[model samples]
Target: MEFEEVLNNLKLEKENNLAQECLNEIQNRQVLFHSGFEQEKKELTSLYRLRLKTAMDLNRDKFEEDVLANWKKTIDELESCSAKKLKLNWVRTEFKQFMIFWNSETKKLEGIFYLYPKNTIKDQEEYNTGIINGGLTVGSKKYNKGTFIKEWK
Candidate 1:
């Protein structure tokens, strides 16, 4: 099954379980008055909250992993499909189109790279330089000049 399907199933299961537990607790008056019940309720609530937070974290991590795995698989398929179309040791038009489609769907290359071919070597160099300058401009705008460098390192 696809990664998204797996994630959707997991999310649905979690929601259903939570709803059933909530209904059962309400039916039983699980937190109703009893000696030390308040304290026990508080502890259980905390534990539930912690477990929920952990589950959310795990879900996010799993989603990211799935996305990356699917992306890699897509790239591999594209490479195999384009193997016969390669020209001058560079990717062909079909591969370029595939990349564009992938990037558009993923938004993974936005504000990062522009992978188009230029008419000339000089234009290609200029494009690369422009991309680097643009990255620096964006970085400076979002943060203090050295902030990212320091934080990342």
Candidate 2:
């Protein structure tokens, strides 16, 4: 499966499980205690929150590991071949795009990078078009918070 699809599935599973747990808790509370369950409810909520955060952290770590491993494999393959320039795009809960080029003189892969926010397709296309041509002119759009100028070193 694609990386993005895997992420989406993971998220959906988490949400569904959490929702079901919440519904069950509500039903149990209603059946067990009609008057004095406030403290217990608070404690349960706190525990659930902690568990939720831990689950999220684990998922994030797994996702990052998968992404890095895939990237290493791709880079290794490129190095073995005659590929010159490659553009890689990823949406890591947001949009990120970067380019790498094989530098014959330096005997290395060099990259120029730009990050873009997850936005409407029209906006994304317009912003990426500017980047591909050369560089984005200063103060071009409102979604400038996602733009980052960096190089792969």
Report the C-alpha lDDT of model 2 over 1-153, residue by residue, as the tens digit.
222222233243344442233223322321111111112323433443464355446645533444444344444444454434332222221233222222333323322222233465355545556775675432222122223332211
Q: List TM-scores for all candidates, in order.
A: 0.17, 0.22
Consecutive 10-residue window with the lowest summed lDDT within model 1: 88-97
- RMSD values for the candidates in order, in angstroms, are 25.9, 22.5
Model 2, CA-based lDDT: 0.32
Best by TM-score: 2
Clashing pairs in 2: none
Model 2 misplaced regions, further than 4 Å: 1-63, 84-153
Q: For each candidate, how many residue pairs have backbone atoms clashing (under 3 Å)?
A: 0, 0
Model 2 residue 23 lDDT?
Answer: 28
Residue-level lDDT of model 1, residues 1-153, one tens digit each, is 122222232233344442233223223321111111112323433443464355446654533443344434433444433222211111112111011111223222111011222244334335445766676421111112112111110
TM-score of 1: 0.17
